[model samples]
Target chain A: MDTRILLGAFIVYSLSTFFYLLNLTSERKNSYGRIAHFLLLSAFIIHIMSVVARYFIAGYTPITNSHEALSFFSLCIAGFFLYVKKIYKVEILGAVILPVVLVILIFATAMPSDIRPLPPVLNSYWLPIHTIFSFIGNAIFLVSFFISITYLIVEKGLKEKRFSFSIMRFPSLEVLDSINYRCMSYGFIFLTIGIITGSIWASNAWGAYWSWDPKETWSLITWIIYAVLIHNRMAIGWRGRKTAYMMILGFFSMLVMFFGVNFLLGGLHSYM
Target chain B: MSDIQLLAFGFNHTTAPVEVREKLYVSEEEIPSFLQELKDTCIRELVFLYTCNRMEVYICADDREKAMESLYRVFCNRFKIRPEYLSNYTYTLEDKEVFRHLFLVASGLDSMVIGEPQILGQVKDAYRIATTFNCTGFYLDKIFHKTFNVAKRIRTETKIGYNPVSISSMAVELSKKIFGDLKRKKILVIGAGEMCEIALRHFQKEGIADISVTNRTFANAKRLAEEIIGTPYPFEDIPLLLTEVDMVLSSTGASRPIIDKPLITTVMKKRKNKPLFLIDIAVPRDIEPDVNNIENVYLYDIDDLKDLSQKHLSDRMKEAEKAKKIIEEEVEKLSRAINQVDVAPLISHIVEKFEATRENELKKYIVKLKNVDDDTLKTIDILTRGIVNKLIHPYIAMIKENGNPAVLETMKKIFRFGEDDEEKLDNRKQGE
Candidate 1:
């Protein structure tokens, strides 16, 4: 039943993604955008229900497996997107980000979703806090990555003195850049806390605070990239195309940290 | 009533030069007397829109030729222009053409700048003033309301107003692209030239109040600064001000480059590589071309602004076609609404005629049944009225669906509802 609810949420997300894409090509009328926002909100609510149901059924945190973790990650991204859209009035961002959420949800569906008893090493009080903060942080980074991509496209269009449909749909580069900076800063702080909590959990479970685990190394690398971006933006006032490139790179490293570490590196964190 | 006609008469930028339009321009204070004079001349409903680029009067009048003659005399007397000169510039439209023309005007499609937004507001103001003076009757009120709706629809449904086309506006747009918000951004005007002042005014409209003015002559800078409510800085302070300001608008009378690469590079260092937007609108260029090569300086000369403005203008022109389509659709809708209104009186007339005949027949029968009680008579009256209403329902539906003038006329003639009765109905409807 929880899986069915998750599937329903996935369908709604795909619809929202399609509507947002349709809105970009539509005439200046905002009905398509309004519909997309409504669908996204519905999807987010259903996703929450599914997560809650999974938690109730499993009698522990639902993010004990790759399937649940990836689903939760997509849910956090959609939730953050709705929050930012409410504050920033950047509906156009959904046109770029909803597809990314849909892809993550699709990848989650591809993984095994069967409820499994927690592995002996996975049972812990710190699981919820560590995983929730990390997923939320990763979700925020995903938004920044999408916004940075939009910024680069719009900036390139302006520089080349060309106007395309996608460029016209983008928010101004200044708005995109400011939102990118905000997302990066918030993402960095949360990721820092997430890593610290994870290390604390590691020490309690494995008698070490620091581990050379592949996920840990990649997460650190991702955190450093965003740290540089934030520092450069605030202290040195670095912005525009260079910052956009950094955000894209940071998001890639985060992807490697989440997926590559699990599938290829096979470290102490491989169970996730 | 037969003579009443919708008429739109105007001399716009296409038909008249600035000199002619200036002569015919009526100030706001003069509107009451002008509307009174127009009313006295048999213009039953009227609105006059006076903008810098166009002077127009839309009217519903009883005698078209006499109304035009009186309007011509008013124009000749008020502006002191000769009748022949006025006639050469004046163009007139009638009936459906009047509606089409007014819709085009209200939607900014008839603007000199092509999709400029000011004309719609001017048109609305004219309608409001006419309404205040009791010069706008039912037809004018209905059409003006429809016109405003059409304008709003065009504005929302098309990209006509999406881009800025003027050079100064384009400069402001470029600054927004760089700075995001101009509210707290400082602007430095490098010269007291008209173009520089114009660009500053554009920035002022964006709520940027921190403006510093400097010129080759300190006195000129001070005067311009006082005029624009900005602080006047010394010409020698350009380097220091350059590091502080987010944008510099330069349009000096210099024959060669006044700001060069080395100078801005030093300023960039002082400002720690922050973005600087330099708009050099001078002929020989106040800022050197190579200054754009500096780390964070974006330089755009007059040609670049003009190019951007031209591109935007063409884009608006393309959007204008879409706007025209919207206007066309709205015009059709409005015409259908008008026809629906026209059918209302016809339906009422048919019902009234049938009831009158029914009353007459009932009166004739009352004498034959002299002993009939009041209650029975009331029931009989209700029954006859219901029958008449049921008999007219199909005809009313038919008339509403196919409001063909010839068929309506034939129906009215057959029922002895003459044109005079139609006029009375119209007057009664207007009174209500």
Candidate 2:
């Protein structure tokens, strides 16, 4: 039963990729898109079940160790995006979003084990708070990344005056710009909370609260870039392409924090 | 006989010179008369669209060739040109090609400069003209509605139409740069020429709706007012209008500079240091170029519209592409709908034909025979129509299910009308 549900989720994610690409290539995918949305939602449900099943086999929240943490991170991002999309109808985000979620889940499928016990360093209540907020921050930035990439793609099309036809489906520039701004704002707040919680956890566990770990440094850099953008947007009345460019750069800083700090440069937080 | 069609003919600055274009331009008074005059043009629908850059006669005809040729005659009569003179300047397209042209024009792709909003208003004017003339039919009106929709799509989907600063609009914006806002701005015009009219229209479009037109002659000022729909004051009121208006444009046909530096300086001090914008579009000199130095006044001739309008193409391309993609998609969808509308009736038509034939045969041979009238013949009538309906259900069903939308109607027509078979085939085909 467990493997069947997991397999169903994996299949659902894979199919979502195909439909997303199909929606791009063809214009009248009314049925195809509905099917894709349904499949992604089902995948999300099944993923939830699989996580519950895994936790039943072991114990605790499936977010402590490396394999479980990465799997949970991918699920959280997908779930959040799907939730926001339901409310906002920001349909253009689908082209960038679905494939990334599928890719992350597929990567999660390659991991070695189920959820395990947390280490002593992660035993504090502040640890889970730090990780949850960090995961939320990651999710928000990923959405920002989606919006920023759309901005670049849309900007290129507008340059060629490619705003006609269904060649590349998109929302208006104003809407995309606004969505990116909101994403950055939400992400910045969560990032601030996540960092503060991480600092508290570090102080309780290691006695040195603000040592410059790779993730901490990269996140600070990401925060600075976004802060600059927000300030420029608010103060100087910066708009359109300039604001879009800065958001894209901030996402790069986010990617460095998410994947680079963990895999390449092993940090103190990489025990699992 | 199949679906709706469209045809258009006109020349813009690209096709004709300024003299030819001005002669073709439709004044406000001219629109109603032109619409009334086009009643004789042998068209199912007619729209006389006249802007500064172009004048177009859009029409729908029962026959495409006949309509095109008749429109040619209408043009020659309207412009008073011989058949050979400038007849080659007009462009024509029909059906979907005509639809594509209309969409592109409405979306600002076919403007003298791309993304001009005036073309949209002109298109709407043409539509109004057509409706007023009672020349619009089902297809031409549908085409116009779709054209406007596509234009809106391009605007919202792309950045192509954003921040458009035409030469006239740049004059307005520059005026704003000198003055803070132009809500109650007083505007002075040296000449009552076409450029002045264009400038007035631009100012109105840019929200500087309050305007006072001053021309050299009282007669010309009145005539211009009647045409441009602006209040015209005498040339004596020029300095007074100057104090009231924040901007002034001079396109007069003067041989020498009219408003020199000293003349504008005196006017500016009277206005209490209020910023003024002056635009010189005359060849010789109407307002001296040295008036640009006048205190709290900014002046630009023709060259400045281009300088401020260097909006980065690279920044606009993404949105423009998105708009075009939307148009193409809509065109495709509309084309499909048009094709479906074309094909559906034919298949239904074939089905009806079969059923009618079965009824006719039954009524002739047995249904009308009262001598043999009983339950037997009544049963035969019901069975016959039933068999006919059953036989046709699959053939027409196949036509509806065909993948190539273009051929669906042709296939339906063939099944309905092309092949004739013996009457024996009906019942037998049904049983099979």
Candidate 3:
């Protein structure tokens, strides 16, 4: 039943992504964005149901396996996206962000989701705290990454005196830049707390506060990149193309930390 | 009484020069008395639309020639122009042509600047004034209502009014395209000239609050700033102030370029490479042409703005064709409705006559018969009613389907449906 709900959410999210893509290519119309928003909200509700159902059945938060973790990451992204959309009224952001959610969901559905008893090593309250904060932070960064990408495209088009569909569809550079900064700052704070919680949990579970595991190292790397970006933006007024480039780099590092560390590096964090 | 005819006579920018239109222009204070005078004339119903570009009168009357003559006499008397002089500039239309002309005018197709939107508002104002003066009857009321609907339909269904033709509005549109919202953006106006003031007014209409005005002559800039509720800054402070503003509108009388690429590039550095939109509408270009090549700067001169507005005007002209098609369709629909009204009484009269005769004969027979049951009486009544309906259905259908004037006239003459009776029926319908 949980898988069915997750699959339902996946299908709806795919449809929502299709609509957002259509909105991106077509002449500016509010109807396409409205439909996409409705579908995205529906998918978010079903996804919450799936996660809550798994939490009830398995007797723990549902971030145990790679499948569950990736799914939760995508869910957080959708949640943050809907929140930003409500607050900012930037409907065109979906064109850049929804496809990323779709890809994550597709990868998540491909992974296995089976009921597993909690291992003694994983039986701690800190598990949920660490994963939840980390995933939320990652989701926020994902949004910033896409917004930064759109900003770069629009900025380039304006600079070159060539107005394309993308240039016409996206919001102004100032708006996009402000949203990117907001996401980066919020994501930075969440990741800081997440890293702190993970260290505390590591000490409690493994008798160490720091590990040289690939996931741990890559998370640190992503953190450093964002730290530099936020610092430069706030202190030195680093903005426009440079900040946008840093956001893209930070998001890629996060992708590697989330997926590569589990599949290729086989670290102690591989269980997730 | 003769058949009421729809009549429209007008002088527009195209038909007459401004001097002739000025001669017939009606002030707002004079409209009520003018309408009273028109009501005293042969026109039973009338609406006078007076605007800067046109002076038109739409009337409903029993005799078109008499109404026209009276209107010509009134124009001569009111404006003190001879009938011969007025005749040289005035054009007249009647019936369906009148409807087509009014629809075209309401939809902005007949505007001096094609597809301009203010004429629709002026038409609505004329309608309201006519209503207030009790100069509108059913025919004029229906036409104005239909006109408003056609105007709204054209505005929505076609792109007739989508583009801005004026230079000031075009500048505002360009700024909106760049900034998304002008409310938060800061604008600096250089050289308090007429064009700059007009563009500032457009920006004000767009709800822009943050504005600064600068000029070589500080007193003029201060006066313009006070008028537009903007802060006045000295001209030499523009380059320093440029770092804080998102857009610059310059219409100064300068022989040399007031803004250059190096100046904007330095400002861009201070702004951290944020975009800047510069509009140089001065005749002798206020901003350097090479400023457009600078990064994060979009500069448009007066000629460029004119070209953009011209392009938009051409786009509206293309959409005007679609708007005309909509008006044509609406005119046809309105004509059909009017025709339905014309023939409705005749059809109803024929049906009423047949039913009354059938009822009279049935009543006489019922009295002659004895001990008639209720069911039998009902059956007899239904049978007679059915036969009468069947006999009259073809004629009613024919009159309604064709609604040809000749057929209506022939039927009216044959049945001796007097004009007084038709007038009574129309009034009765209006009361209902």
Candidate 4:
């Protein structure tokens, strides 16, 4: 995928987030909504093509070799969220999270277009599988992002005596919580697979199955947050604002693994 | 005023215990028979809404006194409650009063919880059951449909169900009552339906985190399973899931009893009889009727929704009343407009005739002799038409006054009622 095309898709998604957020007080019209859905579909397809084009240029999948995979995962997260929001008729949900997706994709586009292939140790079938699952896992955390936004706004609306017209466009609190669990549950599974695949590839490359690397530790931390959320939801009846808050905090750990681990903390997962 | 008849009766948490509510439940099985009893009433439109909190029957009749007597006696006979229990609690709404009551009830104003949305669904279900028995008539159908639409308008235009604790949120409250602390419990959902998702989501939010899922299909079950990190087991895995899980919510669409007698009994023996709260939300019933017999087994079928709905209503009384007022005001405005539509056309016609004559006089002077061409003659005709409108506009407007008080009163009443007949009559008179 051309970095420019991927950048363009990010811009389109970012604008949609703006338009949908502007729609909060504005009258909701199906005509514009239908247009919004088509635009997002177009953007998702374009985004996929961008990733494919980049792979063709890179000679091997861009999923390996660190920097590209992390950036690609964020765009994947945006595309998945936009698709899910449209399916459920909760398009406003995209308004809260797509901005983050746009920023991550923009950052990915700003990096060097390409030059290096994976090290002889980096080439493996598990690398692509691991990357795909890990991206999918992070996409679920994005869903939690949207739901937490809705829970807060709805609470404020109800508490004030006047229901915000913008809140009307959002899903019910029950539906919001449901979406969060759905995201966290899927994200958990994907992360588990990601860890397993990373371990297997690491052993193949360096003769070890387990290493307490920064990226690995951070991924584990993300996994624990989701585990607590699921446990709270099933056993203790922990949901609503508290669960939403935890989901967000967990996503932050994921954020650290992405940007902070690479540029700020400079871990093995980081690339020059 | 004709001898219009009205009867308003309901059984809610305020009036009836859960045992009595279960007895008078008028289940999906009983709805068919209840409508059969109402078939012979002189009532034009009949609505039967049964919830754990209340069973309300609103009948529209010209002879309000007789209709109330007949409807009240049926309730007295069915529940075996005495007449003393009837007049004191039962409310009667005849003619216009019936219209207001239906609107109020549909809007959730008359409910103990004033703004709850469940009554609309319950009312729809009751109407559907009545239709199955071929009991609802023209008047009831129109009125109830109108009532529902008005309720919809109030919901959309205002914030009726937005405040206080909602019924779904309170479902968690019921869970807390059973388990004391939610964090220690495990929830197993039997199906992948919306309610199961909602209940699972709620339990997840509450902090009771261990969860398992057993659905009809393994793939959907696995998918939801992968997301939640719960074991996605097959249907045969249910008995095992139930014993280990503290709460089980079954919302599957099964033809016969899916959770039959032998399955629940064997399952209960596994966990030394841990408190099993089973919410059977399915219509045909996913759990066996005999499942209720097991010790420490609290089985709540759809009948319990009415009570749950009632508890929510009491918690939301103020909002319900506000929503009801909005619906009633809307109905009143509609009735007044319906009344005017009948009389307005009669006034429009007499004015049209006066305008036509004035045009002829003005055109004779615009000179029929002027260019003797089609284009020139058309322009002259338009000029004369304007003159006619200016000349006859006042006289036509005064016909609505008609110099008669009786005519005015009749039109006022017709518009107040918003009957379709009056509008048709004006259309007929205008045609002639």
Candidate 5:
């Protein structure tokens, strides 16, 4: 039943993605954006239901396996994107973002989705708290990653004075930069808490608080890079193209920490 | 039907020099009187558009020869210009040519800068003024309204006015991209030259509240500062002032670079790396090129700005082709509508002529049949009317459905109504 609900969410997400792409390409004034926004809201509700159902069936947090982890991450991204859309006129960003979410959901569906028993080590309340915070932080940064790319394209075109209709549709440089800043600020707070809660969870699961595991070490590196970025942005006045470049760099490091640490180097957090 | 001839008379930037255009320009205050003078003559429907680049008058007249003569006389009397001299610089377009030219002007295709948006507003103002003076009737009103619609359609359907093409506007556009809002931003002007003043005025219009001016001569700086309501500083305080302002516009008559990389590096440190935008429009270069490499510093020199403007101009040129095609398509559609309107009166005249001929012949035959009863006479009248309508049904239908010019001419010839009838209709409308 949870799988059926997840499939319904995926279908709605696809429809929303189609509309967003249409909104981007269409020159005529239309309500495609409002329609897409409605669909995304509905998909978010159904997606939350699926996660709740999974939790009830599994008798623990649903982020234990690759399928559950990716699905939840994509859900967090959709949630954050909807939140950003409320504040900024960023309907155009959906044309790029919704497709990415759709692809991630596809990967999540392809993975083994069978409910499995929780391992002996991750059988605690810290599972949800630690994983949810970390996933939320990663989701916000993922959105900022795409925002950074858009910022670069727009900034380059304006700096070079080469204008195109396609580039003109993207949010302006200032709007994009502000969104990036807002994302990074919230993302940094969540990341810091996630790391602190992770260490506390480690103490509860294992004997020590600091294990220096491969995932732990990599998450530290990601945290330090973002720390430097935030510091530079607030203190050194790093903005526009420079901030965009830094955000992209931090996202790449985050990719290595999230994916590379799990598959390439087995770690304490590689139960999936 | 009214026999109002559509006429457009004007000279634009390409046809007349500035001196000639200025002499012919009618200010807004003078427009009502000028239009009143024309109304005193023979013109009943007219609109005058007077801009820096063009002087135009659109007319819907009953007598073209009389309207032209009156227009020439008014120009000669109002501006102290001779009639023969005015004719050399002016152009007169009638019918279809007038419609096409008006469409081009309203859509900004005939502008000095192709696809400019300001000319459309000016055209609207002209129409509004004409309406206030009660100078426009059915014909001019319909054409002007259609022109506005076509202009709007072209704006949405084409990218002709997408980017800023002028140098000052380009600088302003780049600053917006970097800084977002210029309302609270502070700017420092390096020189008091014409380029600096023009660009500064553009910036001032954007609401840059804190402006500082500096030049080699303190008096020149003070004079420029007083004119534009900015604070003037000595030239030696350039590095000191750079830290306080968000943007710097430098266009001096310097032989060497005035501001260099090292100076900006120190200034950025002092300002803690707040973003700085620099526009250097000097010929010999005001700021060094390497200053652009510093983080959070954007520098655009004269050549860079020119390249952008050149590219945008070319882009507009390409988009103008698309806009012109759209205009031509609309012109064709509207021309067809106008022709349909023209043939409405002709169609009614044909039907009326057939009915009149049928009644006259019926009367002549009825007088000869004195033995017929009243009921028989009524039946005969009905029979003759039905036979005439059925016989002429195909011809009337052909003329109404297919507004073909040759068909119209043939129908007129068959009825023995030729150019003389058209002249009579014109004369009758004049009487009305």
Candidate 6:
């Protein structure tokens, strides 16, 4: 039943993506964005219900496998996207971000979602705390990645004086840039907490406070990139196209940390 | 026959020069008495659509030639123009052409700038004024009401009036795209000339509150600032103002470029790289073209703005074709409606056919009767008359209510009204 409900969420997200695409392509201004927004809100609610049901079935937080982690990642993205939408009039941004979420959900559904015994290495309170914080941080950066690309497209159009219909309803360069900044600050805080909680969990599981695992090393690199972005933006006035480029770079680094280390490197965090 | 002729006469931008139109233009204050004078001349239902581009008078009158002559005399006497010269500049349309012309005008298809929206509002005001003066009757009222509907229909069905094409409005649109809300945004106006003042007013309408005016001459800046309730800055304060304002609009008569790359580069550093929008409408280009290459700076010279405007104008032109097609369809529908109004022949033909049938059938029944009495014959005649009138009443009501053309044609066919008779009805309806 939980898997069925999750499938229901995937379908709703697809419907929401269809409406956002329609809102983007059409020139006439109407309520397509508003309809897409409502659809996304309902999809998020159904997604939360599925996750809660999964917890009741498994008797633990569902972050121990690739299926659970990817599902949780997509859920965090949808949640953060909704929060960003409430703060900004970036309805067109959904056209780009919702497809990414849908793709992640597809990969998640492809993986095994059966109830399994919890591995001894993952049985701790830090399992949920570390994974939840890290997924939310990655989700925030994911939204910023699309926003950065939108900022670049609009900024280029303005510089070239080529006003096309695709980017016609996009938020301004300032608005996109400001959203990137907000994401950078909040994502950095969540990432710091995730890293700290992981190290403390490492002390309990592996009997060490610090270990140079591939995921840890890559996360450090991602953290450094965003730290530089925040510092330069506040102190040296790095903004507009420059800030958009940095956000794209930081998001790529985060991808390597979240997926590459687990899938290829076979680190201690390989359960995810 | 209704005997009411629809007439339209006007001086428009196409037919008359600006000087001639200005001379003949009637202000709103003068319209009531002008209408009364036409009323005294035996012209009843009329609406005077007065706008800067065109001044057309639509009238429903009993005498076409006399109405035209009276209108010319009113133009000559009211504006002190000679009759021959006025006749040379004005064009007149009648009946079907008048309906088509008013639809085109109301829908902005006939505007000087095709698909411009203000003409619709002006047309509405004209109809409202005529109604207030108690001038419009059923015919005029019906046409004007349909005119408004046509205008609204065209607006929704096409993208003709979607984008802003004028230079000042395009600037405001771009500003909104850059800054989501213009409220509390500061604008620095260079030169304080008429062009700058007009563009500034456009921005002000968008809620840009903090406006600073600067010019080469301090007094001119002060005067313009006072006029618009803005702060005046000196010419030497250009760099200082650059760091403070979000947008800069420059239009001056200087031969060389005024604001350049290095000045803005230093200003951007001082302002910590806040985004700056610069519009240079000057001939020699008040801002250097190279300044656009700078980071966090967006510069659009006059040529770029004009190019965007030209694109929008072409978009409107493409949509105008669609709008014209809609108007043609509406005109055809309205033509059918007017023809239905003049369906007196059809009504009479149906009654005569039924009467002949009733008389023939009654004669046959009477011949079969043995020793028929006068009272019995009267009762039979009354019964046949009652049946004929009752059968025809609903069909007559449907035709009078302007039934759909297909249904009306089916009724005509059921009555055996021939194709030749239909041609005669149309000919008489067209008054041709």
Per-candidate DockQ values are 0.33, 0.02, 0.31, 0.07, 0.44, 0.58
Q: Residue pairs in steric clash, candidate 5? A: none
lDDT tens readout by residue for model 6, B342-406? 57777887887777677767776788997979999999899989988999999898887764556
lDDT digits (tens) for residues B151-219 of candidate 2: 876776566755545667656644543333466666766788988888788777656766667777888
Off by over 4 Å in 2: A1-57, A79-98, A115-127, A141-271, B1-16, B24-26, B34-128, B136-432
What is each predicted model's overall lDDT from 0 to 1? 0.84, 0.70, 0.85, 0.67, 0.86, 0.87
- Candidate 1 per-residue C-alpha lDDT over B1-432 given as tens digits, one digit per residue, 9 for 90 to 100: 123577898888999988777767787788889878777557889998888878889999878888888888888888888999988998998776788889899888888777888888989899988988889888889899989988888888888877777888878877776677789999999889787777788899999999999999999999999989999999999999999999999988989888999999888877867778898888988999878766457788888878777887888899889887887787777766766776676678778777767767877787899788999999998998889889988888877777456776666666656467666566445433
- Where model 1 places Cα greater than 4 Å from the true spot, the runs are A26-35, A163-168, B293-296, B332-432
Interface RMSD of 5: 2.8
Q: What's the TM-score of candidate 6 when only chain A is evaluated?
A: 0.97
Q: lDDT per residue, candidate 6, A1-272, as tens digits?
A: 88999999999999999999998876555468888999999999999999999999998899888999899999999999999988987888889999999999999999999989999888888989998999899999999999889888888888898866644688877788889889999999999999999999999999997889899999999999999989998997998888889989999999999999889987877885
Candidate of highest lDDT:
6
Q: Which of the two candidates, 4 or 6, achieves a greater TM-score against the reference?
A: 6
DockQ of 2: 0.02
lDDT of 4 at A183: 81
For model 3 the local lDDT of residue B395 reads 78
Off by over 4 Å in 5: A22-35, A56-59, A158-167, A235-242, B356-432
TM-score per candidate? 0.86, 0.48, 0.87, 0.48, 0.89, 0.89
Q: Candidate 6, TM-score vs. the true structure?
A: 0.89
Summarize candidate 4's per-residue lDDT along A83-199 as a digit string, tens digits: 567556676665566667667676666766675856766577876887788878887786677678777676454333123354446665555766777887878888899899889
User: What TM value does chain B of candidate 5 have?
Assistant: 0.86
State each model's C-alpha RMSD to the native: 5.2, 12.9, 4.5, 13.6, 4.4, 6.1
Tens-place lDDT per residue, model 1, A133-241, is: 9999999998988898888877766555454555556776768877887888889999999999999999999999987889999999998998888888777777777
Residue A91 of model 3, lDDT score: 85
B1-432, model 5: which lDDT tens digit per residue? 135568899799988888898788777688899888877456879999888999899998878899998888888999899888898899999877787898899888999888888899999999999999899988788788989999999888887887788889888877876776789899999999888889888998898878999999999999999989999999999989999998999989999999999999999888877778899999999899989888678789989888878888888899989988988898777777777787777777777677767766777777799898989988998998899899888988887676556777787778655457676556444433
Candidate 6 chain B weakest ten by summed lDDT: B423-432
